[model samples]
Target: MKHRDSKDEEKVYKINGSTSSMGNNRKKKKNMQRLGGTGLSLEAFANAKSMSNKYNPAFKKKQREFYKNAKYVSKYKQSLKQQSQQIDAFSAVRPIEDQNRTRDVDEKNIKNKNKKKPSMEELYKKKREEEEQARIEREASIQAKKVGREKAEAERKATRAKMFKKTKYGQPVMKYRIEHLLQTIQSSSRISVNNSN
Candidate 1:
């Protein structure tokens, strides 16, 4: 390789020169002093603020109670405002025809309320009737379920008896096995005949 020229060498050195000592020429910064009017040291001032009577327990308790009461009052007022708004909206949506109908219904309700109350015997009879009707429906549902269960049990019994039947020689019955064998033989014969054709 050819040696670098002096001008080129100087240019390379300037580009790659170390800048580690560049900051050393800057003046050292001095810490700022805190101005104090209270004749106390730094630690003492900090501790004094923490122990100040302005934040005593009694004052904090009173502030907490005041805030709690204010929160409850605001919540109650908001609820009342919402209820009034809902009532206003409901009344506004009622048409004149509905208002008349509602008035008639209200009059009927008032008249019913003014009428003589049912005697105790009549009330008891109505209650008994309702209870008897409920009991009848419940009994009907239970009977239906019982009948369904009996039907399922009979079917299961029939299937099990068919599958587990035994001959006089104490050998298990093989009627289903013979039928399966016959079907398989017929299928094989049909396949063979088709292949021959």
Candidate 2:
């Protein structure tokens, strides 16, 4: 005897105390069976429930109310469209009137220009007024700056005076000279007393 299939010998098979010569491939067969006959009807189930609800009087009434609300919503949308068209037409006419009004105002201004030109005195007075206002602003700004500078200078001077008083070198330098003069006066007094004695 000779073994003809080494690959077939690698798999184990047992059925009723006897091994089948072929591979035990039942899993693939069962999956194919499941694909063929699960017996589920999703569409039919949904249709059955919908039919029952459709025959119910309360459900029919609710459906009518829904349809009525939908109709009103569509009517409202149509009215909004018509109102938008009217607004667009009104806006189209408004700009032309606004332009004509502006043109009339321009013509009045041009008519006024043919009258007497502004006097040189008036022009000079206007210029002088502008210059005076500018001068006043500059003077106020300069006054504020001067006040700040003076305050800073005063603070610096006070700090400097305080630092100078705290410094060791600011002590009296003539202390030893005064002590020497005192000793000389005492010695002269002793010599004068001895001479008098």
Candidate 3:
């Protein structure tokens, strides 16, 4: 093998001995110098400026419109929330007003009777009586349901007893077995007569 210098190596890789890596690097340096050290060509800068000028105003306008619409939506939602809260407040006050009216009527009746105001103990006793009445009603409803269930069970047992019979060996047998057998025999006879026809 022959020893080669760097110049010979460059010549071996050059395309048709006209272009080399050094030549390419020189061309790149020239291009960079022509671009004023900004690395961007003048044509690229012009194209970018035109694109930004053409699209930026429209994009900003659309952004403003979007924000305006969002503002309106939020305001409408807040108003709706306020209205619902007002309606809730009104509804809540209505029940309290009704309760106040009943209390006022009770106070008027007591005044008309020329009686002193009931003591706290008397109020507590009245509340307790109301609770006891409610408990008694609940228990009565439960007892009625229990009695209804027992009556239904008794009725079911009676129906079952009527539909079945106990043999001497104490085995329960269907009481309608003979009726079912007669029905099947009649049906078979009818079918046979029809076939004969």
Candidate 4:
């Protein structure tokens, strides 16, 4: 049984249950026949499109032409009409100030284009020099850190050995002198520990 759709076009739906996958496939075939046997998946359509493109590869040279053709050939006429009538917020032209700013930026870029360009050899030389400087700086820093750490370790061992050494004559005393600084430290036990009177 066939029925006319709201579009006045006759759409022959399966009078029986075609909800199952296999039944839906049969219905798809019937629908394809109704629409001139051109119901193809997007991938199949794209492949066919690419194959057709070989014949007239330059047909869509301008994207605007393609867009215009798309609107013209769109199935949703009412939607197309509404789109044409409505103001697209996204497509609004930039303000005058923004346009001027963009133009100024473009002019500055155009002017910059006139500047001399360094040759590949110069660029490579500059990069190599920079890398060499970075390497030298890194090595210097690492050596300085190593030297600082070694000095600190040596100092610590010397100080610790002095502090932990057995007191000479049973007196815990350590003394040292820098250029103008004299330092002294003594570890004292209880008053009765090492005193006799």
Candidate 5:
């Protein structure tokens, strides 16, 4: 047979056994079967315990009262109030003594502190070095991109040549087209410098 008939195969079947639940919902099947035929309801069976094994619940009343008094809350509040008052009294006065310098003297002092500066020659050399490094990196990236493109083009041409080789068609037009494409690709792939004598 060339191929099997698709209609003879069975269709795929999917059964979802998972449940959308918060926790396990397993039920005791044996107990269910035993109680199912009896006349008692499930709720009656749950609440129907013997009197010999029962005891009183812990708390029967809903409302409750605490009897302990805490003394530390008022003490802490008073201490925090006194500390805030002390901080306010000290913040009005400056902590350090200021120097009595005139406006012109202050300006001269500022200028002296900022006197040191880089030379023009050093700045120029740093700028030139940065530019040279950037140019070198740019050239390297361009060369890498050119190499990648060349590799990809070569692989494409090889695959096309292989595909045409396997075909046995003898039409003259198709043969010429294929040969021309392959030859043009090969010529382009060659690196020929025009500066030769």
Candidate 6:
């Protein structure tokens, strides 16, 4: 079917329960744009505020407190900046402690440089002490080695004398042939052990 007007057609074919107020409000709001703070006037805002009765006592108190806190924060920032500047100045100039330390080190170096060198008598005394100590240690080691060797030699002689005393030729004949008999016994022992292995 052809419609005489699109508006009438829409009205006739509208939903069974839909309202026209929603459509009318959407069209009206779209035609009007809010110009808020872009066109705001100080005089208009002042008049509006004077006419409004929405003031609360707590709001005034909070505004005053915020102003006081902002002032304190700005003062604190200035103090910190001043303290940092002072620190920079202090660092640029060397402190007395560092100057004293450097002076002390220089003085100590001078004192050490001017110190006396060792005398010939001192050098001779040190050399003699070192040589004496070395000689004493060598003598002790030699004495201990001599005692050990002497003990071992005594034991070997005693063993040979015992072996000779056991010989069939008797103790008297053993005196003459003891050295030769001992050498033969040692050689025979070595040969027997080797052959057995």
lDDT of 6 by residue, 68-140 (tens): 9999999999999999999878766988888799799999999998999899999999999999999999999
Give the lDDT of residue 30 in candidate 6: 64
lDDT of 3 by residue, 87-197 (tens): 888767788778799789989998988967799999999999999999999999999999999999997787666557778898766655666567779999999999999
The TM-score that candidate 4 achieves is 0.34
lDDT of 3 at 105: 100
Better of 1 and 5 by lDDT: 1
TM-score: the better of candidates 1 and 6: 6
Candidates sorted on TM-score, descending: 6, 4, 1, 5, 2, 3
Tell me the deviation in Å of residue 35 in model 2.
99
CA-RMSD of model 5? 24.8
- The CA root-mean-square deviation of candidate 1, after full C-alpha superposition on the true structure, stands at 14.0
Model 2 stretches astray by more than 4 angstroms: 1-110, 114-116, 167-197
**lDDT by residue (tens digit), candidate 5, 72-112:** 66677889999999977775453433233345678998999
lDDT tens readout by residue for model 4, 29-117: 99988889786799977887788746454775666688887877785787777787664443356577876887899999999998889
Candidate 6 Cα misplacement greater than 4 A, ranges: 1-96, 167-197
Q: Model 4 Cα displacement at 105 (Å)?
A: 18
Candidate 1, residues 2-92: lDDT per residue as tens digits? 8898677656765888322332333222111233233678997788679888557678899999999999999999999999999889988
Model 1 lDDT-worst window of ten: 24-33
Model 3 root mean square deviation, Cα atoms? 20.3
lDDT of 2 by residue, 20-101 (tens): 5443456656776989955448996667668874466687788899999999999999999999999888867787878799
Question: Candidate 3 has which clashing residue pairs, if any?
Answer: none
- List the candidate 4 regions with Cα displacement exceeding 4 Å: 1-116, 167-197
Please say which candidate is ahead in lDDT: 2 or 4.
2
RMSD, every candidate, angstroms: 14.0, 25.7, 20.3, 16.8, 24.8, 27.6
* Candidate with the greatest lDDT versus the true structure: 3
The C-alpha stretches of model 3 lying farther than 4 A from their native spots are 1-115, 166-197
Q: Which candidate, 4 or 5, has the higher TM-score?
A: 4
Ranking by lDDT: 3, 1, 6, 2, 4, 5
Weakest lDDT window of 10 consecutive positions for candidate 6:
31-40
